[model samples]
Target: METKVAIVTGGNRGIGFEIVKGLCQKFDGVVYLTARNEERGQQAVKKLEELGLKPLFHILDVTCEKSIEDLAKHISTHHSGIDVLVNNAGILDFDKAISSYEDAKKLIDTNFTSLLTISRILYPLLTNTARIINISSDWGLLSNIRKQVWLDRLVKDDLTVEQILEFVNEFLNAAKMGKSAFFSIAGKYGDYKVSKVAMSALTFVQQRQFREEGKDISINCVHPGFVMTDMTKGMGDFTPERGAKAPLYLALEAPQSLKGSFIWHDCHHVNWDD
Candidate 1:
């Protein structure tokens, strides 16, 4: 029997690294630890090897259309069909205000838009009932999350991907005019929170689209709890390994009917309305 295959974008560091490790341990298949930098990608593979795990490095820069296309071609030619795609590659930038249009645009490209690009390019390589998991954040909640304040107003239902993009761009435009960080860009810096919100919404829309088309593929979005990693400066309540748990659960354990939903760590269902 042919082994299964998975592609993890931005798997070089932080939570992406932990996700790669978890997938390798739990799934019997090839896990492509994709990174834009060739050296970093290899380094991650080396680290995984030291742990007696098999991880192959595939250089991928999700923002580049050609790069995604090339990876799709490469994967199609070299391995078995892809069984799972973890859209983990993204960025977080902070400015005094969202008026930094250049920086804000970059965040949108990587965090929200690039996912659609990667999925489009790689969709061809996916086998029957493939899974696509978008890594989202709780900050994307509609309610403000300052420090440890839990937001209870994130509307996860009734959001389509197009609506989310519009929201992100609107925030960018609003931030340009100093209209409230497009949803709390003041504290955390950059468009991090807004971008996550857009991605989560997009995940729902993509799932709905797939279902409408009668495809059996499972598509969903999830937020990993605060975990210690380079991104969180190792200060989160959970370790990178622990933070990776929810994504791992979604990728390998979640049921098919649960597809196209916004979920929290460990595959817990989330109320988009909150």
Candidate 2:
């Protein structure tokens, strides 16, 4: 039998690291720990090794197209395809004013655009039974999108990726003009929230497309909860291990019937209000 493989991006530390540790303990095959920095990736692997868990390290900078392509090629050549993928790599800058166009653009690029690119690049290498879990946040709940028109578009069953991209660009354009004040969620940490919303929107789009293609793959977005991590500046309530449980459950335990669902950390399905 071929060796199964799971890849977790941003696995060098925090929740990503905990996810890797859990997979190493549960997954029946190789668990890869990927990070943008090689040195940190190696260090993370070393720490896992201390626990007698072996995790492969790969350099992955989600924002870089070449890096994503390289990882995909490697997976294709060495493992045939990936059985599991956790898009845990994302960024948030609390210091940047939410209204700053530059800051918001950067957040969108890293949190949404890069994940989209990486997913597309590695999609070809996904096996029929592959499970793809997108790490999103509760802050991205559809309720945050107060504009009726925008909310309608997002919840539309037939929403297209092109349309979603257009919506994101439109928001960015509005932000550039310093006129995003009308946005209901454009307050402190608004960029982070907006980016997560976009990510969730993309999740729905991808799930629909996959179903339309008649693929057997399972795709889902999840909120890992407000965990105590570097991103939260260690001010969160849950530990990294506790935060990893939700994603781990989705990756290893969720049934095929649960595909395309938006799950909360507690493993409950979120109802997107119409």
Candidate 3:
């Protein structure tokens, strides 16, 4: 078997942490347990070592182009192309409303744009038939929309990535004007949902692009079931380990054919439009 190389962003804590731990045990490869903070990343690595797991710490700030480029350079020099890339770093804010422009923009930059930026930077370093597991959520699915069934209509039938981005831009514009009918009707934060929808859409877009380019890479998005972690303040019912299961499964264990899927942990297919 080939020696695989994997990178897990935000691997110092929460589901990201557990995914790194799980990967160390489940996959035979060099696992880069990445964190933006050098201290935190190394501490996590130390703790993992104490637990008999070996993982390397890489300083990665997914939001920063320089950080990502540096990582690409390091990987290019030290190893072959990456075998798995888990775009797991994310941020959340339930404060105020979409009209809080700064807060909303923070969400966009963290939850959506940073991952996209990281993906773009690392794309050149992915090996043939590599796996890209994007952590998403049920909220991204159009079926979660309370009404406006037509919105679901737009995402039906393996909707192309370009179409998904168009809708995402529309929703962002709606949130900017405080006219997000989805928020009003769904009674939730529209910006966050729109961002995840965009994230999930990006996974599909990349998957298809790889297919069209005849590349063997497989990019898939996954929704780890809600789990208790710092992100949830222990409110979630499951543990971080539980949430980590899905992303790790998709990234390290699932069959290749299941790649490029937007799915939930129970192996249920995600209907982004539904």
Per-prediction tally of clashes: 7, 0, 2
What C-alpha lDDT does candidate 1 achieve relative to the native structure? 0.76
Q: Could you tell which candidate, 2 or 3, scores higher by TM-score? A: 2
Name the regions of candidate 2 deviating beyond 4 angstroms: 97-99, 179-185
Position 272, candidate 2: lDDT: 47
Residues 69-174, candidate 2, lDDT per residue (tens digit)?
A: 9898888888978999999998876455555788788778888889778877998888988899989988777776656677778888888778878767877876
Candidate 1 versus the native: TM-score? 0.87
lDDT of each structure? 0.76, 0.85, 0.78
TM-score of each: 0.87, 0.95, 0.89
RMSD of each: 3.9, 1.5, 2.6
Tell me the lDDT of model 2 at 174: 66
Total clashing pairs in model 3: 2
Model 2 compared with the native: what TM-score?
Answer: 0.95
Give lDDT tens digits, candidate 1, residues 147-257: 222232234445555655666666677557654544454344547777776677677777777778788888888878877676664567887787788889888888877
Better of 1 and 2 by lDDT: 2
